[model samples]
Target: MSGPACVIRSDQAGICLFVRLTPKASRNAIGDVVANANGQMQLRVSVTAVPENGKANQVLIKLLAKAAKCPKSSVRIASGQTDRNKTLLIDGNPEELMAQISQLSGRTDT
Candidate 1:
């Protein structure tokens, strides 16, 4: 599939990651960047943790931290906590984080 426009962006705080989280999946993984029905791009993430009592969300944070090579405390769910789609804020050097994200998603354009 063709890549979406952009799934990660830098702001005053740090890098903002758009994500579509799949809880209770067979395995935990970070998938490609995909566009939503409205054409907004988001990273695809799947975790085996069930979506209850913020369990899946916590797992998502840990997964992202490992993938991004950052501390788990640096990752936070900025929005969409109760939904499949979520916005994650990673605290660190935006450039470095963006580079890692691009490499992980296999998109050079971003």
Candidate 2:
């Protein structure tokens, strides 16, 4: 079954992303795409890079940007830079954005 589209919330600063990151995995892939009962898509990523020297964070930004179909410069790690869970700022429609992510994750859109 296809996952539901993501919902983007506007903030005083910008759009926020609730990202769940997995460090030191075999590879980076969007997995377990689920929208919370509240309608927020909780994204899980498996990354091979260890969380050190901002390597994983940088990788996460690039990968997430690609998935969101936005320029890398458009995707910014707003908070939790030093933590596994991060909040991202991406400027775009949540549904269209999630569709791109599903494509990148090899999931067929419904």
Candidate 3:
């Protein structure tokens, strides 16, 4: 018997990021940076608004947009809308965007 099958594609445009969100904090700010066992950059953000009614999501989008220096409409929540870990679809070069994020977070991609 074969186990669950999966196919990995190489044409993917965006990178999937794992983020830890802290709602109801003082303001929207990026906190400690950690890397999972897989060496993925994990960031924590403290949002001022509660998680009710998609407020946290909006806050995250705004923060990311500001960080990316793009309009809010350009950054979109692709998945994990109801979960802390989210995947954002940014309409631009992933490599360049990742570089910008690395510069902002002071972390080098390894």
- What clash count goes with each model? 0, 0, 0
lDDT tens digits, residue span 64-110, model 1: 99999999999999999999999899999988888898888887875
Global lDDT of each candidate? 0.90, 0.69, 0.65
TM-score for each predicted model, relative to the true structure: 0.93, 0.68, 0.75
Residue-wise lDDT of candidate 3 within 1-110, one digit each (tens)? 01111011111564344466778998788766665455554566679989899999899889977886777887777677888766577666666666666555565641
Model 3 error, position 82 (Å): 1.2
Best-to-worst TM-score order: 1, 3, 2
Cα deviation in Å at residue 30, candidate 1? Answer: 0.5
Question: Which residue segments of model 1 deviate by more than 4 Å?
Answer: 1-4
Sort the predicted structures by lDDT, highest score first: 1, 2, 3
Candidate 3 regions off by >4 Å? 1-14, 35-40
Error of 3 at 61 (Å): 0.3
Instruction: Give the per-residue Cα lDDT of candidate 2 at 88.
Output: 82
True-structure Cα RMSD, model 3: 6.5
**Largest lDDT belongs to which candidate?**
1
